[model samples]
Target: MLCVTDRMKLIHTKGTQGIRGHTILFVVIGLLITETSTQAANSTDEELLNLKLRLNTWKNRYRVLCNKYSELAANSSAPVINCTGCPDGWFQVGDQCFLLTRDVRVDWQASKKKCAEIGSHLAILTSKEQHEALENERMRTRVAYTDFWIGLTDVENEGDWKWVDNSMLKTPFWNTLKSEPDNNQSGGEEGEDCAVVDSKSQSWYDVPCSFLYHRVCQMDAIPLQ
Candidate 1:
């Protein structure tokens, strides 16, 4: 599989004008090698044909996915992606790709910017199922105790919470034990505006946006057609 950068380079290179023919030639060579190996293993011709057909079908699907990605990248600030599924570090969960930042701990605003730099937004979970899926992935991490900054915030209006997409919070999984979104302003000059999901408690809490914490970035994962 080609890396995102390599795919972008191939698409832009003038010398790659005959990429279609080159790609077809490579596929044919690969198929021939497979056919030879299958024959050596005493495989039937019909089985070989079926395998080739499956490969061809997948190849066509890959091309279509690549073309769609190119169009999206060209039209917007989306990251240049050639293949489908999640990126290298991202985990897939029900058509969405999520990345839990492990090494870096930054303020909520900085975390949001970092996610945007990679062509993804802060994690905006809409349903309990999605949230649970992400939480399960988070639990699998070595540093499962650390809290993660989500896309939720009450920046504009103090009590009116909204996700990164500007959608109002509907089905909140707030930690009632903590009495969260209490907008605690004991030590800080600003009120608690950003939301963070506590890994230990398994619930959300509103904290000062300036507080340093790990972040979760999310984006749509292209489905294999």
Candidate 2:
């Protein structure tokens, strides 16, 4: 009876030892699985963080581009302004300046257009003073070769000689022999009823206005101050 009881006790001790080893192994496996899962989760989080950082970088670049576009768009629209320069040589008229070129060979109308382009009119001898001014200019320049054009024409009515500026010829300064036209006398061999200044001799001439010649234009020096 004593031998049987010792054997049974040994069996129970062995079974308990085997059960404890199995429990320890199961605990180690559980710990390894938990560590692997945690490591995967940490890696996924790091990858997500990097992706978010990249997205933010792209967003910043987009914002910068938008700002630059807005600035350029704002600056594109503006108004153009007009500016004028002083005309070449003559003297200042009322509000413009003038320049009389050395006598050029152009027709009467061409001469007038040339002067107008430079912001003035042909030498409109409006007053005796203005006529004297022309005579003086001719004397000073010593350009007395032939007749030159002045601001005079009879475009509308025959015999009604008028300044190219359309002002009436109230004053007279005939060179002794010739005079204003006797009739409208539409342009004939005399071109048009235009004026010319004989640059060499400094005498005025009533040539056909259509004849081409060099002429003068006037400008306003400053505002009529």
Candidate 3:
């Protein structure tokens, strides 16, 4: 596992299933290094093209990490690395920030609290563009919601489902060919307020705010220099 950290004092958290996650990253890095070191050996254009692509990807990943590191390190003693790559837990969402927390189900309020405890917030889809970005990042098919929690609800009004961030939910989307819970039936009834982005193919689903969901959290990405 690559357990490099800025401060030796900072305890090593279990970094990304490192032994496994890093296998792919390291293989790619090694390929580029070997290719560059052996450049005079007459490499194939195919190998060179692959190297260029991989290097470009790493550079882009580094840029994203640098931005994130900047924000988290600001106004603190937090030191930043020149380029070790993106933090283990996070995945990139276009220029946004994302982390795959797996299937941890928690109630709306509790989920939000947990996200903060981890230095983040429950996933907040503030716009259609962001929603599209998230789908692309996750490939939208592998994960499950079991009705996961999202940053939206009518804590203010009974029927009005708005994003917790107060961002407009202008884009209508849903799973199971259903738009949303009408809030009329009484199975997992009232006060159960929270939203779930379902189908991994459509917009998302908003049920009672109280239903526990396999949730994901998102945080503000560090700004680019």
Which candidate leads in lDDT?
Answer: 1
Model 1, range 97-160, lDDT digits (tens) per residue? 8888886689999999999999999998766676676667777766655589999999898999
Residue pairs in steric clash, candidate 3? 192-208, 192-209, 192-210, 193-208, 193-209, 193-210, 194-209
lDDT of 3 by residue, 1-225 (tens): 435554433433335456666898899999998988787555676688899999889878877877787778886899754433234556655445666567556678888788788787777665667665556555655554324567777767776667756765565565545635555446454643456775255366556655666666787655434
TM-score of 2: 0.47
Clashing pairs in 1: none
**TM, every model:** 0.60, 0.47, 0.53
lDDT of 3: 0.64
Which of the two, 1 or 3, has more TM-score?
A: 1
**Segments of candidate 3 deviating more than 4 angstroms:** 1-86, 127-129, 132-147, 188-192
* Candidate 2, lDDT over the whole model: 0.62
From the highest lDDT down, the ranking of the candidates is 1, 3, 2
Weakest lDDT window of 10 consecutive positions for candidate 3: 7-16
Query: Residue 59 error for model 1, in Å?
Result: 11
